[model samples]
Target: MDHHSSHFTQAFIHLDRLTHNMRLLQGLVGIRPLWPAIKANAYGHGAQIVGRHLVGLGYKTFCVAHVSEAIDLADAGLKATFIVLSATLPENSPYLVAYPCEPVVCTVEMVESLAGEAARTGKTISAHLKIDTGMGRVGIHPDAVADFLERCRNYPNVSIKGMMSHFPMADEADKSFSQQQIAQFHRTREVARSYGIRTFHFANSAAIFDLPDAHSDAVRPGISVYGLKPSHVMSNPQVDALQPVLEWKTRITFLKEVPAGTGLSYGHAFRTDRPSLIATIPLGYGDGMSRLLSNKLELLIGGVRCPQVGRICMDQCLVDVTALRGRVKLGDSVVIVGRQGREEITVDDLAQQLGTINYEIVTNIAGRVPRIPVGPSMAGASTESVGDDGTLKTLTER
Candidate 1:
């Protein structure tokens, strides 16, 4: 059976490259336990798939954004420690205590509420205290951490296992600000230690690659584990040796020749300068292919880069295939974000075109598109089987 016969568009995940990328991260973090962040559905790579692969590799700990994401893992029978990066609202997200998850709490009320839930459930909760050193997004103020710690001391059921902070400028060229944040985290660590909190982690993807000193007892890496550098500032090829594992592809459903100067697509924004062959593939902004990329992005068909022309449609886009008019045809493969022969489209390339980051490019891929694993499975992983839509049918689902 033809592989492309299933879904018109697909995202192939290379597990071998994922393993390579993870090993590189392991080397960077040294002895610090690496908590690979799988929030945002493993950054749109399918958390269930990636999480299962990681579990087979002997990786026991993972992190997600909320209680739901962690529960999704548990429901799928993926037994691994999950660290929920976001704080839990005891009134709303009491499910955090129901499942074994480590939630990051910053405010005193959050700490108290969580303690109350722990007492109600007659269970002990292992939580992380988030301190705001500089990120300004969440976490308690450095000056007020002591007061927050004191509040937590009232509840013996709440176990503050980790104290952490986020760095906003860790990827910036100017290291001065990051240095200050690092110093602040170090001071916070000392205070937390006095209160019996010993686990400390501060390094994100950028810091893991740039700041070795910030790799305390545990380190968190989100983007780099998938093999893309967090920022261009850390893109020195020699040191950052990570391989991107995503390959977005679609199949040509229709092909037609147009007269020279013929207008095309939604707005007639593009006209054939010469007699051209237009190929329409099943990819659109609805699938997280940003409409901003209209008439600007390129696709790799037949191992040749073809320019996307005219206004992108909601369900499809047109690519000018005049260069290989006779060589291409309906049902041919087109690569939206991956290699085709010697030509390839990297997520960084897409990010540069949209004036965004590589993270958005990969994470924006819609969950509907089937993510078919394209590499060898780990020893204990389920043998992957594609459903009619090209998505992996879970071992139990089969």
Candidate 2:
């Protein structure tokens, strides 16, 4: 918990880069409010750090995957409007009413429960109506939007503040399906607006980059806000301007010279063909470094790419630092997904190697790893820890 003490691995969150990404996205959306998606711990960039910084930057609203995620941030003193993005049962009405959250509504039972709770508690609950244009997810059908709105109107204490939909394939190279979804949402938006819905949002991170027309009333930019491309097929060249906000780093803990024919780590997955200098960093699958990366992953040390030889263990892994030989030493910096001198390793690089998306590469990072805030704005900011429950604790004061 000591800020000055050595850490096995630390995720350096660049607050300045987050601001840059927001500005670039703001340019794309004009004056429309960007309700950043801070769910899954801001795509594992540390939501408390990201949420607190964004609150300081004047962002009033955020989108989260569940009511509990919003409650976690609210409990951490983040004062913002959290639009709960998932459909939930009526059982969670009390927590939803207690917190400053707008639950996305797709069923009448949920709305009735919210209305009952709001009336009983002497409060008015604001919610968003979800129409399943084509996502085929948990939303009312487009044809049922009018009747749903009418039924919701019966509950005067429950206000339908917005109408929303999602895009299933907006990131694809061919966006014919996305365009059709947009048209379908547009029709429902028109009908919902007539019923006094103030906001009609239909854009996700992919739609923000490729579908300008889908940027209805407000845009929910998720992965882009954290500087990860929604997908490789985005048609806009402007998305390239976004900067990544997280850098995963660790330190060299031990070093040894292994002769030819020497095996490394568990199961002897990698065997040395020649004398090799092997360095062990206190990182492995326990820290979200996938075992699948065993013999294929490369880490950066001394500005050079070093292959991670052998099976990655649960608590440690071996990096062949043969190139650095005498140059590398104990406590030397190692880059997991960051820049070391001129060489850079990004989440996209890891995703490509693992045959997964960038989102998984970050969110998979275990909560045990400390996320240290670092940037021009974070000069005096404190280091924080994300607990297993997803609550963030400040380790030190500014």
Candidate 3:
């Protein structure tokens, strides 16, 4: 599809901002390997596209939630080593070996399964062991680390090259808890080292900017690379250096005037007291715009904030533009999450309005929305279409 030749709601990937963020993150992270987490479809920035962008920018390591995500990236012709943060089953051993991925093993059972896969495939595979010092989600319990290590030593083909842990409160204002988690992680690393594990990585998006001590062998940054604070409470000088890489834009497809006391949208959620001009755009909850946003959100049109009226429909939304001095017209560009003329809407802003985090704002954007790369090299880039299930179609590279 010729992006320049059509008009539809689309998300634009700013390649230039992505480059800047990579450099800024690398600089802040020092010489440690920087693995940008591409899980959740690269936080809805389109994993395949972002993977290509990062590869072009000379990035060698990419991180994802599951090994399947890594396979998706590999299928796209991206040449990068992938680190799967989640556990991979023995049934998935072939995929782990077929693709350049290191899956995180968190249990003794997982260790045996992955090792069996490696032995059967006649290969030595690098895998990461996650320790649950504090984050009670996934990982070998601190008490079980000793036994888990012994199991790994039994299988020489399965090398434990990396040890990592997640920080549940790294983005919080208080550093005491995060400090404790890091300390616990360091102790676990020492115990594992007696058995030969060396690589250590703990810093997530929040820690990459807030916790320098966690910046061990590698730093995995997810949200900050897209220029949104990990949480409202987290910020630093280096955090400001990152840039937003996505912009959601759509053109007004319909407009109309309503008399006083007229209700708008489904269930008449928004009713006008005075005369009003309402504008409608072809974007709705189906596009991943949360239905929860209903009457509580605002969109930018002609550089002004237009209150979203009524409940957002499945394929359309109504915005109140009655406050504008001039008449509201059709075919105007509406900014759902980006800049418009002199004003800008941010992921943080949208997240705040919806009572969520920046991560949800970007990742929730459905894959059906096509992604177009904007910046240098874009002329040679092909527009990408994401499946309803987040399957990224191949981009016709020039």
User: What is model 1's C-alpha RMSD?
Assistant: 2.8
Per-prediction TM-score? 0.94, 0.96, 0.93
Better of 1 and 3 by TM-score: 1
- lDDT of residue 178 for candidate 3: 93
Decreasing lDDT order of the candidates = 2, 1, 3
Query: What are the per-residue Cα lDDT tens digits for candidate 3 across 82-186?
Result: 998986677887788778988888866766777787788788888888888788888877667778888778878788888888998999999899999888888
TM-score of 2: 0.96
Model 3: CA > 4 A from native: 2-7, 325-327, 377-398
lDDT of 1: 0.83
Query: For residue 69, what is the lDDT in candidate 3?
Result: 90
RMSD of 2: 1.9
Tens digit per residue, CA lDDT, model 1, 127-228: 898988889888988888777788789988889998999999888887789889999889878878888888998999888888887999989999988888
